[model samples]
Target chain A: MTAAKTNDPPPPPIKYDFLGALLSYLVPGLGQMTQGRFGKGILFFVSLYGLFFYGWLLGSKKNVYLPDYHSGETSIVSRLASDLYTRFQFVGQFPIGMAAWPAIYQYVVSVQGNEKPPLNGFMSSPSLEELNNLQRNGDKTWDLGWVYTVIAGVLNVLVIYDALAGAAFREVRATPGPLTPPNGGPSK
Target chain B: MTIYVHLPVLIVVVSLVYSATRYDSWNKILREALHWGVRMTSFLFMIGLVLYALSTFL
Candidate 1:
């Protein structure tokens, strides 16, 4: 009257891959290559960076930026809110990781309130007046250019997840050994 | 215009990036991307048609 016990292999252990995620965040598709997924890594890196740089080119290299200009708000919260409000586009651009760092660097230097900082203009923050001028003078293509950068950055968020989680549909196959289960062989 | 020229490229990139997240194999990812790219392009074209008709009528 007793039912027979069945043996089922345990699910594969899920590793918390901090470094992989970090690497992929810094450079798109890097984590996958580190994890031996070379093709995906290459695809990710080339595609993401291509899109990002193309957008940079479209915008004439002035798309990704955090403005040094901020209205004098009393609290840290207000200042933070003001920055976000002004640079809301940065939320999209920021996820591309270090590629977007120049903007932040520009802001830090700008805190000194320099009339003209001695730094390369790469992703540098423009003054509020300058930003307005750029917008007024430039056309719709400029808007689309930043949109490309934003899309590239946002897509990278997914890449980071994939780097940490490994492939979503990957089967956890035990190595071939005396005790290992024999159902499927190596992937094609 | 640059915007119109870039639409297909955007679709292809978006499809490839999204497909990469779903599967490990490059072959499967690329295949899925092709399918999704077509679907997305068609969807967008339909929406454009609808908007165009609305603008003309209204």
Candidate 2:
């Protein structure tokens, strides 16, 4: 009697790693490196961080910041909503991890009315007049700079996802049958 | 020219980063990056042409 072939059971869902995702979010490509994908991690590091920092440099260290709201309104939530609308570029930049946090710190300090003299303008928002002056100058480079930063952050999000979800396509598959050599030699 | 000075770097970075996410091997990554970079550059060029036309006429 012919024996039946037994099918293998499905593998468990250990592919999605939340810790790896968190590590990747903190440092672009780091989780993949830790997961033994050294080349991929390094590539992500160079690509995302390089783009973000280059954009920051092009902006003369003035981009990646959210301006504080002092609208004198009693509703904190409404004020936050309004400021978020105006400073939406930061939403794109925030995924870049610690490199973008100084802006948040500055915004929070200024919003809470504890903006100190020691704050040496590291990611701090410029005054309305100063911002208007810069805008009036029609410097297209500044606009492009922040755009690069946003793109870097957005792209890093994909890196984080890769760390969590693993590769998009399976790298291995079953070969149906052995073939002859390219030169038409017999199969071994 | 000043505005577009950063384009080449941006193009390379974006294409590489994007392609890296979809594949594991360096061979595939570099090849896909080239395809993505070319397509994006062409698309951007088309947009620039439109803008240039608008500027010239209006």
Q: What is residue A4's positional error in candidate 2, in angstroms?
A: 22
lDDT of 1: 0.84
lDDT of 2 by residue, A30-149 (tens): 999999999999989988999999998887778888876646767877777777788899889989888898888887788878757226988888777877766677677777889999
Error of 2 at A113 (Å): 1.5
Local accuracy by lDDT, each model:
0.84, 0.85
Model 1 Cα lDDT, one tens digit per residue, A96-175: 98899888777666765765655567788655677677779877777888999999999999999999987667665666
Cα RMSD for candidates in order: 5.4, 5.9
Off by over 4 Å in 2: A1-14, A117-119, A173-188, B53-58
Residue range B1-58, candidate 1, lDDT tens digits? 4468878778889999999998887788889999999999999999999999999998
Q: Identify the candidate with maximal lDDT.
A: 2
lDDT of 2: 0.85
- How big is the positional error of residue B14 in model 1, measured in Å on the Cα after superposition? 1.0
